[model samples]
Target: MTSVVPVLNDSMVAGYLERFITEELHSSGFTEASIAVSGGLDSAVVLKLACDALGTAHVHPVFLPYKASSEESRRDAGAIVSACGLAWTELDITAMADAYVALEPGIDRLRTGNLLARLRMAVIFDQSKKEHSLVIGTSNKSELLVGYSTWYGDMACAMMPIGDLYKTQVRSLAAFMGVPQQIIEKPPSADLWTGQTDEAEIGVTYDTLDQVLFLLVDQRLSPEEVAQQGFEAGVVRAVERKIVSSQFKRVLPPIAKTSQRTVATDFLYPRDWCT
Candidate 1:
């Protein structure tokens, strides 16, 4: 399934997110922000957006590498920092991740990859605590809807600015922002274990899935309408099913009727109320 994404030349995604960063910093009363970058399109976009929004001086990129991870990850992560002149540091999780798998025998390498993700998040949270900054999250809409990420690992962030974009849109925006084409085009992997491709794990190309998602989710098109637009109904149904089944990931915990003014549901604030 192909798509017809018009070349995006202008948007405030960069500027808006920048403004958001500044506001969050001021309101949250923090001085800096930290993010975990894997040298993939998603994190590259996040890092670049962070640098643009907060200035490279205020954005810190932390790269966590495990033994089975690619050497290219560290190299390219440096490339991103040097390109943007952002501050960065590398942490090798080889020892820590190995110790985890050693105790939990029969855990597959992919599971180990997820553990590595949480380990990195622990480090990010620790750094945020030290720097007195917020930890930024990088999960795109495509990954979030499909439950493609570990819950408390990559999904955990003090605030997320890119959760609305689909994977295809993320890459498109990355190109608009002049993110390295090599990183943009690289096969997305958690780099947890050898030869792990997101598409290979999910069984559908992001391009194909996002197109179907736009029809089903954004436009509210019926499954037949989606299929009419050159996609399989099965694909549409599958993605929709996954979206429905994984609704918990996209939302805060359900509000129970404990009180008249509960937090997530009954006590939400309206837009502009804070200002």
Candidate 2:
């Protein structure tokens, strides 16, 4: 009922994230991590956390930009790499994306954008293998909950340092970590197409959307209860629908329950089991 927005202690979260990254990497027997810096608040925060967690030497940041990507994306991403003195590489996926686009000349932005996202992930995974590091993800709780991410694309990662943090919380942590003000102030975007902002694509401001998500997901409130609390019934329904529809993106592909220990069915092993 109350329109109270969720607040996070940036300092506490920064420390917690730093420790989480270290522990996750250590348990996996990997001392290094590869991250795809998208020049957004979320990735910038993750980049800073990776540096604090494993040191500059252990963090490898890759800037994956395409032709449609804004120039600021590269500049902002490069600044983080320079500030941390971390070694990074850039991979221009324009040609690769064009190859697919050529197949379907009228392909919509969503399809092309998804292709680009997957290409970026493919490159990040390749770099991970080459650097002997795990792929660190930058997806936030807000995006993950609403399926605002691409499955096996931007959603792919060995471990997500900020997975539990919401988009608003990411901005808070980014400020605490001293990420560039430009990145923090800019409208959130995946940069899939020119002038495409995340809020515009999602059709709702993150402030309101996050509140709805917190009530529905974190507070375990039903859609009706959330609407009764003052949120628009339409907005509550939209958020709830996204959470249900996008559930598939949050987990491993389902396996048939034919065997006693089917993978991702009855048989699930901890990611650190091998370690």
Candidate 3:
């Protein structure tokens, strides 16, 4: 059988996502959007879509960097700001992150990285409130499926225009939007620490992961079935484990069903209650 993942029409996806974002924000009574950009392809694509959705003036691009973040990342972020003529905000989060580190001098790299991610989200939300804007999300489906995202950190957002797109599709859309080649060609990273690349940490390139995920997730294949398609058993198992374990991060905090109409239980309703 041919690959289940359909070849994307970049232009159509871009138009669809941009319209989705603009319409959702307007319906929510928010005329502005604030997004944190890491100078990575995902954020760059989001930045472009937001700017196209609601003009540059109404889109706020925030770059929150810690001390270990690469200089190249900063330059690339600046390049985007310049190219889009956006009023970018540079907030150095090094001091703040260090304070937490100091409190626990021997904390591991993973802990420190999570702190940095959450700190950045805090900054994004703060900026959104200051500008009366909604926090836009840049996470892609591959990250979401593989449990690669930091919960309540990078995952906390008022809206996620790119959440449904995989990392591969993100690149396709980014190229369609004329995102800088430097960004598109660079290795993907969260810039949480020195020499940290996402694929390295994940132990699989996005192209490989996305393919298996397309079979496992979108196609809803059994792990055995996916492995039968020539995927390594170890990889299929690992990917399935991630999707199962990360279920909490993908949903609302579960409330105890003590009452008959508990929120998130029987009382489920659209957040835009009136609309």
Q: Where in model 2 is the C-alpha error above 4 Å?
A: 1-3
Inter-residue clash pairs, candidate 1: 18-53
Q: Tens digit of lDDT per residue, candidate 1, span 112-139?
A: 7778888988988987887777898899
> For model 2, what is the C-alpha lDDT against the true structure?
0.89
Cα lDDT of model 2 by residue, 126-182, tens digit:
999999999999999999999999999999998988888888878878888899899
**What TM-score would you give candidate 1 relative to the actual structure?**
0.91
C-alpha RMSD of each candidate structure in angstroms: 2.3, 1.6, 1.5
lDDT by candidate, in order shown: 0.80, 0.89, 0.89
TM-scores, all candidates, are 0.91, 0.95, 0.96
TM-score of predicted structure 2:
0.95
Backbone clashes in model 3, listed as residue pairs: none
| Candidate 2 residue pairs that clash | 1-229
Cα lDDT tens digits for candidate 3, 42-89: 888999998988999899999998999999999889877777889789
Give candidate 3's error at residue 179 in angstroms. 0.5
